[model samples]
Target: MKHSILLVEDEQKIAEGIMDYMNGGEAEYETCFTWADDGDKALELVYENEYDLVLLDIMLPGADGFEICKAIRAKSYVPVIFLTARGREEDRLYGYDIGCDDYVVKPFSMAELSAKIMSFLRRSKGLWEKKSSIEAYDIVIYPDKLQVFVAGNEVRLAPKEYAMLKYFMEHRGMLITRDDLLVRLWGYDYEGSDRVVDNHIKKLRQALGEPGKKIKTVFAKGYRMD
Candidate 1:
């Protein structure tokens, strides 16, 4: 599969070099790259296009890469790699804190960066293949089919309800906030209230019947699949 990558870097030479290396056939898979010299443009591409991975520079002309990464995290789980000159421990920690998949300091080798990108891509593909379907308790979810089975009986779910249930089943024990669900399922452009998440969760639970008992409401927080 040809993976699309967004390269956000201010330095034209550096960006071109990285792009050339990525597409130069050093790896087994083909990588097509789009270059963005400013953070605003980066965010615009991120919102409008679906990229397999993002190669982001920390300091940019408009908004910083950290802010861009946060915005991306709000809507999608696309992998983000910070390629920057800021090599401080705190900077690296902050990158991870803000949801960067990997951080590579400036003056880095293109070969190493290519290897890292390949590794992340392979792992992501493996995970998606492995999670094609999931079973928890008496509930089985076929994500590819958008079908749910409870106690050997198939349950019909609304689009959003199926998405919510699939998210819950995937995260299982993790606490999922309403904001997380809203941004993830409804998109960043959604102007609806957080109560929408509650309404959907209620309907999702009702749809699941007995298996829905595992979906627990956490007071003042969000829902968790026990």
Candidate 2:
């Protein structure tokens, strides 16, 4: 099937290479590209047209990618990816927090990126179609609403934190290793520090407040949610 992709980048050359691969016959998935040179124009495109996926650059002219990703998440569930030179752990975590579907550092392998793009696209095809809410003690998460409620009060959570809570709810009372989280949430292609999962877990606990105690850390192995 053919997919529509928005390619947002300031550099003329980098965008061209990606576009070439997507448009060229080499890619497994057939895709068409809409190019934007800056963040302002990118947002304009986002508002004006409907795209299946977005390839975003973190450092752009009008608004940075983090802002753009948050805006996109506020409106749509369409996949948004950060393709930038920033490889720092904080940046990657921040991207996940702001609801970016994936983060790819620059000087990257084109083949691997192409593969990841398709992977996200495929996985998100029927994403979040579930309407039922998952509840654990005082914390409740609605997959359809993308909202979290603690003690009957609505509490905002980062995207990654929300996902963690959902996963924990789904596997309550089961041992989930750090490696398990790294693979399940971050994907096998992820190259960031394993500490990212721990960082996210810490923040998720803080978000859940009193109910956070239910997430039991299993020594060095992993965590089990009650």
Best by lDDT: 1
Pairs that collide, model 1: none
Model 2, residue 129: distance off in Å is 8.1
Of the candidates shown, which would achieve the greatest TM-score relative to the real structure?
2
Q: Which ten residues in a row have the lowest lDDT in candidate 1?
A: 122-131
**Which residue ranges in model 2 land beyond 4 Å of their true spot?**
128-142, 145-162, 165-226
For 1-226, candidate 2 gives per-residue lDDT tens digits of 6888899999999999998977787677799899999899888888888778899999999988888888787777777879999998778877865667677899889888898777666655444333366666988788878999999999898888887888777556667788667765877567899899899999988988989889999998999886
The all-Cα superposition gives candidate 2 an RMSD in Å to the true structure of: 8.6
lDDT accuracy of residue 137 in candidate 1: 83
TM value for model 1: 0.59
